[model samples]
Target: MPGYRKAVAILMFAVTAWYSEARAGDTPTYSISIVPQFDHRRIEAIWRPIIERLEPMTGFHFQLVMEPTIPAFEKALNAGAYDFAYMNPYHYVVAHRLQGYQPIVRDVENDLYGVVVVAKGTGHRSGPSSQRSGQDL
Candidate 1:
């Protein structure tokens, strides 16, 4: 009777060990997409190094999946295509409501003030950027 009890215990232990080991080999995954706030080629270049560095350190393998444009990114995100992403504040809010993405951190360089100048009156508009007051262009 004691031998039967011991055999069952060993079997349970082996199954438990195997189950835990199975998932250990899998890499954690994360993704970054276009944020509603700043959708520019420059920002993508700036963020590249940071994402590369974070991949190995955090043990989270990351990939940048680019679509046709900013609006495409939003569509993909709404479709639940990524495990995680870096997005703008307004995007974070919308995604949080729509896709259950929460803010883990925000960029230190997130805030910036923009200006447009007419070059003191050339009668021609110079230094006039396309962005309106609220959106980044």
Candidate 2:
């Protein structure tokens, strides 16, 4: 399946499981936060449709939280402001450390990798840092 569809399906299953575990007679509204890689308008436009459909299917209300910047989002995420979150691996590591957040899914098809660039004659190679120098790129 396509990455987005697979992601949504996995999220739906997770949300459903959480919803079923809530205490009796308690109707909780969950918050979903996405990393602020895009502006609020674009983020909402992309996520709102998915959340709207999820609400009815899961029998739970969801609030989409959009932060204005990456730092702002990270601050909120670290503070445990969100019930659910979509974040980069670095943020995920911090979030898991600080808030004990458990990962429900990962996009194996679209893995994230870092690239390093340096001057041509700086005794640096383009691949791993070990090939270039002892210092990390």
lDDT of 2 by residue, 79-131 (tens): 88887778777887787678766555555455662111221222323222234
Evaluate all candidate structures by whole-model CA lDDT and list the values in order.
0.45, 0.65
How far does residue 107 in candidate 2 sit from its true spot (Å)? 1.8
Predicted candidate 1 versus true structure: per-residue lDDT over 111-135, tens digit per residue: 5321211111123221122232223
Which 10-residue window in model 2 sums to the lowest lDDT?
Answer: 113-122
Could you report the Cα RMSD, in angstroms, for every candidate shown? 23.1, 13.5
